[model samples]
Target: MTENKIIIKLDKDKKKELEKRFSQIGLSMNDYINLALNQFLIQGKVPFEIKSPSYDISTLKTKKAMLKTEEEDIGIIKNSISNSDN
Candidate 1:
């Protein structure tokens, strides 16, 4: 999988908090993205809604959406692979 750098616009405090959370799990942003992509291919669908965010140049503020990570996807992927053996 090809990896790319992403510049995220988030509050300093929230970004710091997320960095800490990611560090605790030993998952860098790229690793998390690859995991998500693997799940998407395994599931054969985009997990999140596909929408273009409306950007406001004048206000310099955009609507922010947070994606919650799923810990159960690993188990789900394992189940999918095991079931395929039947």
Candidate 2:
């Protein structure tokens, strides 16, 4: 069988994260990616669910409010960390 090469770019942090995850699962990064691609080819679609977030108004409002709360919490945590370092 003939082989070909494919080059893809990944963020350094993401690459390291994936390397760790695949290692825990006993697969190399190349092997995991190839397995995903092969499954897609055989199934004619991704091997996972693809769905859009429900666009109902209440859902959107709740999500937005939660995100804002999370942002505030993150800011507080950062400030506390910086204060501790001082």
By lDDT, who's the top model here?
2
Quick one: RMSD of model 2? 12.9
lDDT by residue (1-86, candidate 2, tens digit) is 89788897999999999999999999989998899999999999998887667877788999977787787687843332244555
After superposition, candidate 2 runs with Cα above 4 Å error: 52-86
Clash list (residue pairs), candidate 2: none
Q: How would you encode candidate 1's per-residue C-alpha lDDT over 1-86 as one tens digit per residue? A: 68577776889998788778888999976677778788899999987877554545433342221111132354432322344555
Candidate 1: worst 10 consecutive residues by lDDT?
Answer: 62-71
Clashes of 1: 0
TM for candidate 2 is: 0.59
Judging by TM-score against the true structure, name the best candidate: 2
lDDT of each: 0.63, 0.83
Q: Give the C-alpha lDDT of model 1.
A: 0.63
Q: Residue 35 error for model 2, in Å?
A: 0.5
